[model samples]
Target: LQVGCPGFGYAEDMPSALQNAARTSYARKLVDEATQATIEEWQKQNGKLALHKAVEDDKWKRDATKVGLLIDAERDALTRTDVGFRLPVHLAARGHASVEVVALLLEFYPDGAEEKTWHGYLPVHLAARGQASEEVVALLLECFPEGAKAMCKDGNLPIHLAAMYEASAEVVALLYEACPDAMAKLDAGQAEYVEKKRKQGAAGAQAARESVRALLDKLEARETRDRRIEPETLPQTEEETSETVAEAA
Candidate 1:
């Protein structure tokens, strides 16, 4: 006759009452049947609970601050590139109140220190393209003494870009103030070419010369106006002055 305990012997050799109680306890621990309804209720509220937790932890505030700083840094760096030079130009053109940024760049990187091209355009080219306000244009011209004559690849001058875009009279006038010699050079070259064509009896040569003369007239008028308007010097703001000093260090 065999007598068995739960761990010491097989179930077939165990007392029936002890085996039944062991199985009942194992099932209760494994299944947890009492909490099934409560678990369903918690699942329904999970999304709202997660949102409240995130808010309490200030996760959104931290994320926004980080993202905003990153965007501002990226924009600042892009504004410093020569090829992406359009960025600051457009900013100044629109009078975005970021004139200080433009002033800082022009003052610090007059000839575009790290630019790759042989005739890498100075900041003046960008100002011309954007048709910046007279104040902005004058500020750039001050930094680049010969701002109007600054050339790019293939000898394209600032005036050429400005004329192509049909910028305001004020922009053209500003260029004349900075570099009258450049305008005169272009005009003289055009006139001589037109005269040669006329002497050769080229067809439509007279008409072409008339058009050239008209452009010269406009250029001369702008130069006159530019002389009449006093040039104002723009001082670098405090923030820009500090940044420039730090860069020098």
Candidate 2:
């Protein structure tokens, strides 16, 4: 009966702290219905939520654990499109998210990989243009190899942008192999990029282009061999396009 205690009255009105003395982990159902409803309302207004920002923030972009928690908070955020008609997965790829983060997003929205932005930028196209790491690039291509054949608003395939930006050889190679009938594009992409760099006075870029070309020699040889041996099989299916390259490499 602490009737004289001044703090007791305010403490009663304050929200109680979570009781976690014995619990080391929280259940996945952490967001209350009211809070989730508020979140949905906000999403309706803004067409985005905390989950979308989580992937774009550098602090949490690579932290799979934090992203997984955001996912657990609102799984539907995966499918929600922002005003730009872009999903969280699309931002994740464009932001150079880590392999773990990319995998987590894909787990929730496997079809998100196929989604394109208003400007026709697929996840793979963004990933390649941003020069995302090899593992991340490979995963996007593996998920939607058709992205290689897709041209963005700039009329450039993922490989074209990747080459123009001097992405890693591994990433460029992944895009190159994923495209069907890619030799023409590959050859043109490399020569044009090298020339563009040379004209810009980037003497170092020519050497960079050669380095990427060096790694792709085996692919070039295999493609030539296939054309001579089985010229009739000119146009392979999407699956064949990617798988055949994987096997050849």
Candidate 3:
């Protein structure tokens, strides 16, 4: 009707409500894009910012909510089924605790049922490579008891990894505490073999061999003592009687 201004239909004279709505939409889009770019930049900067920023956003508490949403939405596009195994490992290597992630996998995936990379590492291997801390190692050991002994494609165990990378001494100590055999395995015959191989020119290697030999001797003594006990605690068995009978016979 004539009550309404005829100029209202013109592009310049569009309703004030529509103009305000368009501006707000544009502003919101810009803010969203900026927020996304910030997040990506933070992630690229070694995860520290992401870890801290995670606390600020409700959707990022456990596993970034946006990532989780994207994964869910595009799960069909994922070609591989091993993301469950890969994600936790990546997180661990990146120095994120993700304890809950490890626990969830262990609880859901049966022992030895998990898929692995070409190198045969379980999530524990990733954790070992990540921080090499006592707490992280302990958690991995708890989830996969034998994970400490798991071998990489190069035949290096978790202990080997720790040694090669010079990881935390405390972590190496913790792993040795859990499985003393690992030390023996690492030093097994390596000292004598190296000594035999070096004829004359390599003094440094020879010294390393000697040091290793001394270490092995101490380890052997400790292991022997640890395995030995008072006879009172020994279990009675037919083999004990058979030995006694053989001596008397």
Candidate 4:
């Protein structure tokens, strides 16, 4: 009976603009309702929703199935950010969220990998800083390789953070491979590691710098050899393509 309803009635009865307006209005109403419900749920949980808690670092219990159920319950919450502008992916990277949970979050918001915290830390940076498993780190890096080059408010790239936080060699290597220039900054990262270790204790101050340097040197050499073997693999030029076509003929 609503003559001006979206996708309803005969052509003469409803104008295109009117139909679009009605559709937009209805969609907006749905969005507003979902947003309000999410707000109330967050308030009920003391400023955090189930999605936020689902990916937090909790040691008592870890259930990927339950996490999947919660995520499926409200997929929209995947985009909701907390006070720090940290998405669920950010929490998943920094917390105990399983790799599958992280993947699910990415599936919902592929751009979430490039999203940064207020401090400019990409999910890759947090994953490295939190010492996330190599798989998780790899997943985040794969989502946005540019994240490897992003610098946080402290001016530390993901590779810098990975080395400073003593991430596994494999993790650091992933970051290094994502951005080859990261190798040139190893001295800066070594300084940070030394300063941090010195503040903790004088015992391993020199040793900490040595450790980071060792990892950096090792990965750098390996990457150099890889580059040498591959040299470069850029796309063929027009001339090269024409040559190939001629040879085929």
Tens digits of lDDT, candidate 2, 1-249:
012211112222321222211111243355466654654554465444777877887877997766776675566888888878889988998898886687667754667778889888988888878888767776676556677799878787887778767977666656655663644755665756634433453333344334433433433343233224244534577998899899999
For candidate 2, the lDDT comes to 0.64
- In terms of lDDT, model 1 sits at 0.41
Per-residue lDDT of 85-202 in model 4, one digit per residue for the tens? 8988898898856766776566545778888899998898898889886667766765566788889999889878877788766666666657767667668656455344334533
Report the poorest 10 consecutive residues by lDDT, candidate 3.
1-10
The predicted structure with the larger TM-score, 2 or 4, is: 2
How does residue 132 of candidate 2 score in lDDT?
81
Instruction: State, as a TM-score between 0 and 1, how close model 3 is to the true structure.
Output: 0.40
Residue 218's lDDT within candidate 1 is 49
lDDT of 1 by residue, 1-249 (tens): 011111122223332444334433443454345443333343355432321121113232123222222222232432342233433333333332233333333322233312323345555565566555444555555444555666777576766655655544555655654555665556555434323422343323233334434433443353343324222333578998899899999
Top lDDT prediction, candidate number? 2
Give the Å shift of residue 13 in candidate 4. 33
User: Mind giving the per-residue lDDT tens digits that candidate 3 earns over 1-249?
Assistant: 011111112233222444334433443454466655655665666242343333223444344333332222232222223334343333433344343333222221223212355676655565555543354455455435566666767776766555555545555554555555666666645423322322231443234334434433443353344334467655558998799889999
TM-score of each: 0.37, 0.58, 0.40, 0.57
Residue 207 CA displacement from its true place in model 3, Å: 36
Residue pairs that clash (backbone atoms under 3 angstroms), model 3: none
Q: Which ranges in model 3 have alpha carbons more than 4 Å from their true place? A: 1-87, 90-95, 105-107, 110-115, 187-249
Ranking by lDDT: 2, 4, 3, 1
Each model's lDDT comes to: 0.41, 0.64, 0.43, 0.62
